[model samples]
Target: MEAALDAGADMVGLMFFPKSPRHVSLSQACKLADMARGKAEIVAVTVNMDLDGLSRINELVAPDTFQFHGSESPEACAAVKVMQGTKIMKAVAVSEKADLEEAQYYAIVADRILFDAKPPQGSDLPGGNGVSFDWTLLKDLDLKKPYMLSGGLNVANVAEAIRLSGARAVDVSSAVERERGVKDNDLIRAFIAAAKNA
Candidate 1:
């Protein structure tokens, strides 16, 4: 978290999904959130979690945003926004042009939209798989709300990804890690510099 903040990240994500290697406990999330609260937006990332679970997180973490990376409908996203009074960033997995259609629906309910690569087959996790889709698919995207590009971004290719997708914002995960689930500060800094320079 400190590395990202030092690297001038606009947001920092705390994973709440148990199945994900990146998952953090409520206590851990609280500490990280505290560290990043004022410096950067604290985003609580979850899969198809229930409201009760989300409420518990909200009460403890007080995240600035809730990033829903699941099969949540627009109504579900809207409900969470009203319930928590926090911004929502809904992830839309894209493997093809047809996948982008879902972002249009989420745009109405979510404060921001995130375009991520679809999880590989047999993968239990929703994202953070180090997989990438066709960035060109988003070149012509037009939406009322702001959107972010994510999935497979790294120090080596983030600039190209941004240029090709025309993404104003981007998110990274496994690419900045030294190993699965472990973040490397140097990689984080390098990736941020690359993205910013792009």
Candidate 2:
């Protein structure tokens, strides 16, 4: 993360999904978040969450943004915004035109949208698979709120992804990890460097 920051990443993310090997306990996640806070923005990624869960996370990590990566309805998202009083970033898996429509619903409510690749059929998780959708899917999109481009992004492909999608900000979890969930400092640094220079 220090390397990524030095490489010019504007934000860093910590995943809190149990099904994902990248899941971080509140305490463990807190240390990582605290490390990145003020150095670069820290984003706490969660699935559908309850109020208590959010409160616990907020108390521990104090992230600058909450990245919701579940099937939470727009109304639920609104509730999250009200309860947490933190910027909300909603992730939508896009594999088709309908997905873009879905992105609109969250646009009105969320502070930002994360365009990610759709999880495979029967998959319990919605994102963090490192799947990259076609950047052209977002080419014509012009919105009131800024968005993050994600999915299948890595040092080798992120520059093109940013250019094709017109994304100024991006997110990655699996791409920087050495294993399923453990992050690699060198890859993280390279990714940040690659993204900034792109």
Candidate 3:
């Protein structure tokens, strides 16, 4: 959070999914966002949200960035981006080369694309699974704009991920946690340190 920002994280995220252990109540997330706002870009991570839902979140935390981590259509993302008046980073799961194809549809619509691991079909949660794919899968491929590499990233391998994938921006949720959802400040610092050096 504040520590990660001090370590040079341009942005920090707060999860809002009820099903996720990382989920935060409005007041809880608001406080965290308030603390991290001036230091770093605050991002509210949501999944399959409607306009009204998005409005509620937009008003509550007022995150500088919004990350849609679900199976949202290009039109849906575009509409949200326009409605929120904020930059939107649409999260897409990438496992194979074909997975990169979906990035094309969002190239013009989204402010950025977040490549994460594909969730299992029956999994209740969307992301934060700590599942990673081969970095070689993304080597040398370009889609323009800024992009984020987000699946299973941590202090241990973030440098390698950046070197192999050529992603300037990266995100993490589960990897910084000590338990399933409890974020560890130490891990967060270590991750940012590793990423900066990368």
Per-model TM-score, in order, reads 0.99, 0.94, 0.95
Computed on alpha carbons, the lDDT of every model, listed in order, comes to 0.95, 0.86, 0.87
TM-score of 3: 0.95
Error of 1 at 196 (Å): 0.7
Between prediction 1 and prediction 3, the one with superior TM-score is 1
Report the alpha-carbon TM-score of model 1 versus the true structure. Answer: 0.99
Strongest candidate by TM-score: 1
Candidate 2 lDDT, 16-125, residue by residue in tens = 88888878888888888877878888888899878788888887788888889988888888888888888899998888867898888999999999999998778787
Worst lDDT window (10 residues) for model 2? 1-10
lDDT by residue (1-198, candidate 1, tens digit) is 989999999999999999888999999999999999899999999999999999999999999999999999999999999989999999999999999988899999999999999999999988999899999998978888999999999999999999999999999999999999999999999999999999
lDDT of 3 by residue, 17-124 (tens): 889988889999889998897889998999897789888889988998889998899998899888889889999898899999999898789888999988867888
Deviation (Å) of 104 in candidate 3: 0.7
